[model samples]
Target: MSTPNHKAYWKTNLRYLAILLSIWFIVSYLFGIVFVEELNTIRVGGFKLGFWFAQQGSIYVFVILIFVYIRLMNKLDKKHNLDK
Candidate 1:
């Protein structure tokens, strides 16, 4: 790829990373820690929402985000004609 396209691809990749990491931060830190007490007022699967987020929800979200990132990268690669 040319220099400009390469730069664009990397910029888009970094943007994706930034967005995904931001989501993770919100889920793992905000919901799991900062807003725990408020979230604890709700329940899910016989557990407090806050406890779930801290213990399991964040992990689940992380795994899901992995798949999401993979899918996004696949599309990006295709767009850039970098896919095999």
Candidate 2:
């Protein structure tokens, strides 16, 4: 009954992309790379948070992050009536 707005759709997608990218960059580069040593003082399973972030933590975070993104996008899709 209504027309689709492709540009608006892409713009919305781009906004989400930018937000996700920024978060990824900050977590991977800034916290993991720059603050590794300072963060190593705190321990997680015999690993400092920074060390964890550097070695095993980031991978785990990435896995969790994928689920988070899926969950978020599912919610967003429902909110926008875009679910298929």
TM-score of 2: 0.71
Report lDDT (CA) for all predictions. Answer: 0.96, 0.75
RMSDs, each prediction?
1.3, 3.1
How far is 79's C-alpha from truth in model 1 (Å)? 0.5
lDDT of 2 by residue, 1-84 (tens): 444655555566777778777777777877799988889788877767886777766677677777877877787677677898
Off by over 4 Å in 2: 1-4, 79-81
Question: How far does residue 13 in candidate 1 sit from its true spot (Å)?
Answer: 0.4
- Candidate 2 residue-wise lDDT at 11: 68
Model 1 misplaced regions, further than 4 Å: none
Q: Score candidate 1 by lDDT.
A: 0.96
Question: Evaluated with TM-score, which candidate comes out highest?
Answer: 1
lDDT of 1 by residue, 1-84 (tens): 479889999999999999999999999999999999999999988899999999999999999999999999999999999999
Q: What TM-score would you give candidate 1 relative to the actual structure?
A: 0.95
- Give candidate 2's whole-model lDDT: 0.75
